[model samples]
Target: MINKRINITQKNFLLFLYIVILGLFGPVVYWVSNHNTQLPFTGKAEKNPIQKRMSIGEKILVKANNDAAKQEGITAFAGGDYVLAIEKFQSALKRVRNDPETRIYLNNAIAATTESPFRIGVSVPIGGNLNVAQEILRGVAQSQDKINRNGGVGGKLMMVEIANDDNNPEVAQQVAQKFVRDQKILAVVGHNDSNASIAAAPIYQDGGLVMITPTSSAETLTAMGNHIFRATPSTRNLADTLANYAVNVAGSENVAMCVDSDSQVSVSFKENFTWAVYNYGGKIAPFDCDLAAADFSPEEIPSQAISLGADTLLLAPSVRKVKKALEIASDNDDRLTLLGNHSLNTYSTLKDGQNDVSGMVLSVPWYQKAIARNSFIVNAQEFWGGGVNWRTAMAYDATQTVSQAIASGAERQNLQQTLANPEFSTQGATSEISFLPSGDRNLQGGLVKIKPGKKSGTGYDFVPLNMDQIIEAAPKPSPKGATTNPRVKSK
Candidate 1:
C-alpha cells in the first residue's frame, strides 16, 4: 500500500510540473509562432529589409503593432511598384485612420506614379501637439493635392513625407540629421517651435539643405543662416502691429506688461514690443509681471497696473502660459485694455475667456477673413470639414514657397540660392511669398479682437478688427480721474 501511494504521488507531481511549465511558456511559444521576425529558438529579433531600414525606435513605433497590409505596402514601395504601393497604402489607411506615416507613404507613392516627382519633408511635433501637427499637415496635404491636380509645379509632382520631432530640441536635431542625410529630400517645412528651429538650423545650413519654418517667429532665426527661411512674420512684425495699434490708434501708450520668461518667443516679443512701444511714443510701465514665475499673482497684477498709471495691460505670455494670461484678463475685468502676442490666439482663450477676453486684441500672422483667397478657403473647408487657422495658412504658404523653388529646377546645391534670389516670388495663401536678406518673410501681422459669436463653436470668435474699432477705442477721462474705454468693453 505504501509503494502504491508513492507511485501515485510521483505521477501527480509530474503532472503538476507539466501544467506549470505549459502555463509559463504557452504565451511565449504562441508569440514566436505568430511573429515571423523571431528566430524559432534563438530568442533574437530578425529584421526584414524594411525593418532594417528603420531605427530601433522607429521600427518599434511602425512595426510593433503594424498590420500586414501596411507591411505589404512598405514592401511594395521598396520594390518601386508605386501603383501597388498606393493601393496597399490606401487600404491600410482605411483601417488605421490616423497613421501619419502611412499617409505620407501614400502621398509619396502617388507622386512617384506622376510624370516627374520631387520630395519634401514636413517635420512637425506629431507626438506633442497633435492638433497643431494635423493643422500643419492639412495645409501641406491641401497644397500637394491642389498643385498635383492643377498639373503640378512645371509638371513635377511634389511628394511630402512626415517627420515627427516631438517638439524637443534634441529630437529636432536628430530629425535634421536624418533629413540632411536623405539627399532626395531637397527641402523641409518645419520644426514648429522657435527653439526647435534654432536647434536644427545649423545642421540644415551645414548640409546645404533649405529649411522653411511656417510658425517659428524667433528673431534669432532671422540670422541663423541663408539656408533657413521663415514663412511666418517675425516677432518684430507682430510687436509693431500691436504696439502701433496700442500707442497710435487706441491711445493706450502707457502699458503694463506680463511676460513669460521661459519661452524664447515670449522674451523676444517683450523686447521687441518694448522698443516698438517707445518708438511709437508709448512707455512700458514699471510694474512688469512675469507669468512664468512660481509666485505669479494674476489677480494682484491688474490692480497694481491701474494704480501705477497703466491704461493698457499687455499680456505677452507664451503658448505654455496662456492660461495665466487668461487669468490676468479675467481678473482685470474690463478695467484696462487687454492686448497679447500671437501666442494668445488659441482656442483655449476663445473658449475659457468667453466674456473676460471678449474685447482683447491679439496679433496673428494670418487670418482667413482678412485675406480673401476664396478658392483656397473654400477648398480647404471642403477638404478639412472646417475652417483652418493662421498656422495652416502659413504652412500652406511654406509648402508653396518650396514647390516654387523646386519648380525652378533648383536642387539641394542651388535651392537656397534660388529661394534667396531677389526675383524669386510666388503667390501664397496669405499674400506674395518672398524672402528678405535675413530670411524673414516680407509680411506684416494682423490684429483680431475676440467677440461674442457662434462661429468658433465656443460662443465667441476672433473677429478681425476694423480700422474704426481700432481707432475709436481711445480711453476718455472718467469723472473719478480714471481712464475708461467703454467702446472696447464687451456689453
Candidate 2:
C-alpha cells in the first residue's frame, strides 16, 4: 500500500530527518510485505504479472517455492541425509525471520550435525526516532551484507531480525522479552534511548544475551551487568569534553543555560556542564530557565541572557526550538555566543536554519568532518548515498566490534566474560573500540563548530575547532540591563 515512490537518495535524506525529531516521540512502524511475494527461491513464472516494488528496509527473504522446498527437505530427511535436509530448509528460511515450519526442520537437521547461520536481534526506537533508527539499521543491515558477502563471521552466515520499541520504556521491555524468547538470538544490538536501554537491561542480563548499544550514552546504563556494552562515549565523558570547550576553549566567564525539565538528557547535561564550568573557573549565570514548554518563546531566551550578563547561551531543547533560538539570535546585536549539546549535532539544524546556525558550536562523540578523515567514510557515503551521522557511525562500529567478537570465538555462554576482558579491543571507523572495567565506553569525543560551506547537504559543515579557535577573545563583558532591545525589529 506504499504509494509513495521516493528515489533512493530522497529515502536516505528523509530517514535522516526522522532521527532529529525522534526526541519528540512518535508511533513505531515496520516495513512488511505479503507472504506470497515471489522470491529468489524458485524459477516458476506466474500466469499473471504482479506489480512489485523493492523495499529499502530489510527484505526478509522467502523461499522460492516453500511447498517444493519443504517436500524436498522431507524427502532428504527420509533418505537419512539430515545434512541435505537441513541445508534445504535453511535456504528456505534465509530471508525469513520467523517460520516455525522450516525452523523445526532446520533445527532437526542441525541436531544431525552441520554448520548454521548465526542470528542476532536488533532493537531500536523505530517509531519514536525513525530517522536515527533508520540510519542505525542501515549500518547494521549493510554490515550484515558485507560480512555475509565476505564469508561471514567465523565462517557462519550472519542473520538478523529487527524489532521496534518506539523508545517507550514498557515497549522496550516487551522487545527485550521477545528477544529473550527467541533462544537462537545470541546477541542484541539496540534500545536507542538511555531510559529504554536501562529498562530492557535486566531482561537481557538475566536472559544471558549480549547487548551492545550504539548511541545510548546516559551515565548510569553501564552498571547494568557484564553482558551489557556500548559503542558511544558515556555521558560523563561527553559532558566533560563539552564543558572543557565551553570554559577553557571558548573562554567564557559566564555560562547561561536553558534546559527542558522533561528531558533526562537535558537534566544530566545540566548537572555535568554546571560542575565542569565551575571547576574550570567559569561561573554560571544566576538565572537558569528550565522550560518544559515545547513551543518556547525565543524572545525570552536572549532577554534572560542579556539581563543575566551571560556571555554564552547554551540550549538543551529539541532541534525545532534550537532553530527558532538561532533565528532569534541571528538578528540580535548583543554579541552573544550560542552553545549547544550533543543533541544539536544533526544535519537538520544546519539545513533548516541555514546561515543562522553558522558559528554555532556543539560537542558530540563523532562528527562528519572528523569521520571523513577516516577511510570508512568514503565507502559508507558511496553505499548510503549521504554522509553518515554519529548514529550510523557508532552503529557501524558496534557491529564491527560484535562481529570481531564472534570471529574471535565469543559465544552466548562466554561473550560477557570475553567483552569484559581488558585486553579485548577492536578498530572502528572513528577510533578504537574497547570497554572499561565498569563496562562503559572508554572514549574521548571531539568538539566541532559550524562553518560556512556549500559542500554538505545542510549548506554548512561541522569543522573540528581546536584550542586556538576556543581561545578567541572573549566577548566584552556586557553590563546587566545595558543593551537596548535589539529584537525590536523581529517583534
What TM-score would you give candidate 1 relative to the actual structure? Answer: 0.77
lDDT for predicted candidate 2 compared with the true structure: 0.68
lDDT of 1 by residue, 70-110 (tens): 77777788778878888887888788665545665677788
Candidate 2's residue-wise lDDT over 1-491, tens digit each? 24454576678888888886664443322112424333332322132121011111112212232565666676786577877887777676564423433543454455344368787777766567556566676667556656666777766876666676777788887678667766677888886877788899898999888899887777667788878898888766777677677776667889888776655566666766776666656778986575566566666677768788899888755422455555555654446777877767766677766676678787777765544356567766655556667777787788777888888898887888888899999887767889999887788676778888765766798777663354354232235322332222321
Estimated TM-score for each candidate: 0.77, 0.69
Q: Rate the local accuracy (lDDT) of all candidates.
A: 0.79, 0.68
Cα deviation in Å at residue 417, candidate 2?
0.9
Give the Å error, residue 317, model 2: 3.7
Worst 10 residues of 1 by lDDT: 51-60
lDDT of 1: 0.79
Off by over 4 Å in 2: 1-115, 318-335, 368-374, 467-491
Candidate 1: pairs in clash = none
